[model samples]
Target chain A: MTATLGCVTLSLADRLTDLTLSLHEGEVTAICGPNGAGKSTLLSCLGGLVAADGGLVTLGGRLMRNVPVQERARSIGYLPQSPEIAWDVSVEVLVSLGRLPWGDAGAKIGRDAIEEAIAAMDLGALRNRRVSRLSGGERARALMARVLATCPAWLLADEPLANLDLRHAIALMRRFREQAGKGRGVVLVLHDLATAMNFADRVIVLDRGRLAADGEPAHALRSEVIEQVWGCKAGWLGERGMRALSLG
Target chain B: MNRRLILILVAALVVAVPLSLLAGRVWIDPIAPTTRNAALILFELRLPRAALALVIGAGLGVSGAAMQGYLRNPLADPGLFGIAPGAALGAVLSFWAGYAASVWLLPVFALVGAGGAMALLALIAGREGGVALFTMAGLMIASLAGALTSLAISLSPTPFAMSEIVTWLMGALADRSWREVGIAAPLTLIGVGVLLSAGRGLDALTLGEVAARSLGLEPRRLQARMIVGVGLAVGAAVAVAGVIGFVGLMVPHLVRPLTDRRPSSLMVPSALAGALLLLVADCLCRVLPLSGGELRLGIALSLLGAPFFLKLLLDMRRGLA
Candidate 1:
């Protein structure tokens, strides 16, 4: 399902204003901006984790505000920035939590989905491991599995790879790319310009809470726009055919 | 096998109970097999005491595990929500006014007091988001209610009543009769049923309220069910055996790691562990040189739990740092 956030405005006692930009489906949309640019907040609005003061958010042609949380959850999967583990459940049991919207934890489809998601994440060996004992990269992958197990039409991940090593980070982005290729709309918030250029199919750059740039990664990473929004310089780099930018 | 633990617990119950029946101020040797005296001691005295301890321990342990699982906090206890102090107040007031002399009077009042505390805490915690705020509010209310109960007990008239009140506050499984069993058993069973029914919700809650909400759980509704269920079960326990400490606090923590931290699986095992712990403690109170010493079960639990609690606090502080 496609998500639409229109003219969305957020205010913190009128001192900070976070402007909203709209997003669509079946594409990997990366939200990038400088500090205090409200990139994460825009993603929250689209994920229905936070309510916008002004405009409305609609998912699958229905107003999100009017839709029930369970109905909304069925169509949208949200992963917050720095997701907290509230308890020490096993990886398999934790992933099984994603199927809760379908029915009881003991339901046949719920169990099958949990097993499939764990297999998809290549966590078969670690399914029985306690979440507390998993390494940072493994934990990120496990949570991705959990979000995927929900089987939502849209995926919202906020910095899904911030704590990962270089290799693991790319693998996580690649996983998102694969999901988008499977026709699931993926909206993620990231600050890394290099990863956004290489991985995101569509880029939505926020500059001081406004939509500074929204287009193909190559077009959105233009030298002047990058310098203006991120307070940095952008230039073509290396044999990888990727745009590289330096944050000043 | 886990089933072996259940068998051992049952056997311990059988042995300790008869031994308790034979002891007391008047000794009746079951080997002699007397008609009136043996029957009286078995039926009226030790039978009730043993049953009381078993049921109360089982209820506290089950509810405690349920609370910890529901709150996703190892430190969470049935008493964390103020119901213990509330039940104590109700029981002390009933005794002071001489109403507790009537059968089931004290239990009824205890239920009311516990229900009131549970309702109050649930309402207050419901306003604040997250488990942390809920626990903080519960602790505050418990402290307040405990202070009020102390005041009421100090002002009681009968000199003997004062000592009785003291033992009750410290918690004991002494001089129980079959009537107390009749009052506690059915209520506790019903409470256990309610908690078990909410097992799926508890599983969802461990992932945090936002995740639980996303998973089609109304956290507020679940919290309400937890408060009511725990209050009913624990209040019945308090009504029969005073305020036993730590079963609810300790059992879940001890078994969670063994059960791989799966809350659904931990519930029954924790209940079993709780029953075993209480039965052992009660047996220790009977034969272990401290029999006539007005031994408080709460004192024993505190002696054991103090260091454990301190260690847990230190670990939490380190983690936060």
Candidate 2:
């Protein structure tokens, strides 16, 4: 699947500038930027949650604007930056809601899909558990299970790894890796440069609503790019794929 | 447990309906119809009144469930959207203008008022259907309508009209004929139907607005459904029965633990629970030996709602403790 942002722009006080990029399926692409860097806005624009003032986003060679919402949702499962479960429903119930795009939410969630999602999130024991009783990491996994149950073609999560502990964060990245390995599109809006460097096939960095760098993780989030974009004098501590950010 | 609870509510309704028809000031003997006007009273007056109570109560319950679900606020109510208050304003204006003398004009005026409020809410929400903006718009409309209703009560041409306005605004299904029932039943039924269709949308919204939209829930469509649904349902309730309160707020909470707690599943049972509650409450109001004419349904619900609210507060405090 080819996901392209054709100079996508927004007029909401220019929350997003004339940004353009093309992302491919079977790749874990991380959108990395500081706060207010239009990362979330770009993710939303690509997910078709926000309309752009200029340019466009297309999925699988079809213009996103022309795609009907339900159809679009069938192909795109979106998890917000901080997903909120309004009701204290069971994790199973929460996951089943992903079937909403399929017009078969709740009890209509197919057995295979629900079971796979639950297992994918390691939530087999917590399936019947109410969300209010779950820890933050458990709740986050449950939220991911919900999006996974949709079995969408494009899985876009905003800061999905933000609040997780180290173990859960890496576990979640592996899940994204697995999804990408399955020939699906996986896009994440992440603020952690090291995580992006370690886990992302490619990284796109933004600064001040504009694209700062776009390339492989090592090139896009290199020392010079971080200096130019984040205004932080930083260095990489480790080597190659297992690198960590070290500040001066 | 969910299915059983719904079944229990249905059974209660089945039992309660005949009892409501029988438990009024003039208790009807089911075995032998003796009084000359027993058939007249039972068929004409009591039946319509009972039907109206069920219809209005169901409407309020569904509207409340939908509103709470859509807004992601348990404290949310259909009345907060201003349709009920707007309808009440229309009815109050009909009282002030003395057009309530006609059989149809009051509900008609209330319907028009509900329509106006709906239009204004739509205008304020506009193309940007942000939940915060939509909610504020609703609260604003409710406040304006409430103030206008108060003005109508105060500026009544005569004390008689003022009393009439106040009494009607207190909310009652007493003396409602089949005509009121006829007008409300279809509109409310359609309204509930519309909200039920939005059940999935409300469920998806548990993930919040942007995520819900990404799930294919066009917020504006859901917003429109809510306005039309709540407007018709709550508007019809206020038009026919006056400003009845608390049923919407209380019914879903009372039934929440019984169901899966999904916003969509909550509506039907809440509607059933609302109907059963109003029927029993109205029966109690009729049977209670009150010095004043009869306990108004609105006041009765407030009395019930207040205790539930207190219990909720105490429970929350205890949980924290």
Candidate 3:
């Protein structure tokens, strides 16, 4: 599905305005900003989890505002920040819930989809294990598997790599890249600047609820913008292609 | 630990229900033929009482598990949300005010009261997203219902009315007939159906409201359907069996560990465990000798449940820690 976010705007109390730009398909976008910059809120509006005061979101040539919530979910898979697992559901069963919008009729994680998701997330060992008992990193991977089970046209994730360690975090980013390559628009909210630059095809930077920069990560990560908005000095550390920043 | 304990408990309950029935006022061996009165008592009285206990117990267990999962709080109970107390108050007021001249009147009023409380609580809880606020409102509504029930019982002119109210409050299945079972059976089944239909929503809700909404679930609609279903089942059970406590609270806790903390998986097992727990408790009430008279099942459950509740709180604290 071709998903587009057109001139989306949100207003909060105390006269705060959040202006977001439209998103395009076949691209992996990373949203990055300091805390309380409305990065998550932008993702929420895009995923149709929250209503916007202005702007239209159209998917596959139809206005999303007119589509039902469940129907919207069928085309869009979302992961909110700090997602809760209300019970100790097994990983396999939890992942299977991604297929709920299709009702009983749709071909959900039949053996093939479930196996593919588990193997993709490297959660084959944990599939039968209880989610509550899994460690933070393991649980995050399991939740990712759940989102993948739906096989939506777009994937929206909020700080999904927060709990994952280095190796697993890289693996997950690669997975997102792979999904994006498969013609799915993957929108990610990332706290890690290094990974966003290394993995994201494009980065959308927000500053105090407004879109500050939207383009290549290298352009968005300019020294003046980083120094002014983040109050940090961006530093390049040698041939490793790793960028570091020092908060003044 | 979970699987072994469930099996043992189920076995004990299976054995104990028949044993309790056989060891009643008339001591007749299941194998031996004694006086016709003994056989009649076993067939007509004890059997039906056991059956009612099982069904109502299972209903409370499943409903309680569903409620806790729905609200995402272990402290929540049918009474905390006003369904149980509301049903009880409705039945008692009907009884004391002489509105229930016929059997169906009490059940109908009780169901209505239960449904009303659910609607009111849903309005109060759903508007406010926090779990604490929802439970607090539920507690307040329960208190209000409790006060009304007490006042209605006190104002009764009948000489035996106060004792009947006390007995109902204590909760008993001692003399419950097949008719009461018939009334509760179909309603409880309906309630079970409601709980199962919402099972998927409950599963999604575990990931919190935002996650659930993103998955396209309307939280308000799910809350309405769930509360109504719980109230109907609990109200019907209360209308027939009086106000029994602990089944809803204890059964889910006992069965949750067995399912490895999956609320969806716990639903069926919790129901089974709840039925067995109530049956065993009722049996103990029948066999355990009290110097003055028969021990009420509610008192027995409270005696056991108080300590279990403390343990649960400690475990929760440790989890948080």
Candidate number of the best lDDT: 2
Give the C-alpha interface root-mean-square deviation per candidate.
2.1, 0.7, 1.9
CAPRI-style grade of the A/B interface in model 3: medium
Residues B25-82, candidate 3: write the lDDT tens digits. Answer: 5577778756588867877898889889888987899899888888887766777788
lDDT of 2 by residue, A91-180 (tens): 989999888888755354566787889998899999899999998889888998899989998899999987799998988889899989
TM-score for candidate 1: 0.86
lDDT of 1 by residue, A100-206 (tens): 67754578777777888898889999998988889998899898888888888888888888889998998888889888888788888887888988888778776
What order do candidates take by DockQ, descending? Answer: 2, 3, 1
What is the TM-score of each predicted model, taking all chains together? 0.86, 0.95, 0.87
Q: Pick the candidate with the highest TM-score.
A: 2
Of the two candidates 1 and 2, the one with more favorable TM-score, higher being better, is: 2
Q: Which structure is stronger by TM-score: 1 or 3?
A: 3
lDDT of 2 at A37: 88
Judging by DockQ against the true structure, name the best candidate: 2
* Consecutive 10-residue window with the lowest summed lDDT within model 1 chain A: A7-16
After best superposition, candidate 2 residue B227: deviation in angstroms?
A: 0.7
What 10-residue stretch in candidate 2 chain A is worst by lDDT?
A5-14
Task: Select the stronger candidate by TM-score from 2 and 3.
Answer: 2
Task: Report the Cα lDDT for residue B200, model 2.
Answer: 88
- Docking category of candidate 2: high
Supply the TM-score for candidate 2: 0.95
Error of 1 at B52 (Å): 2.7
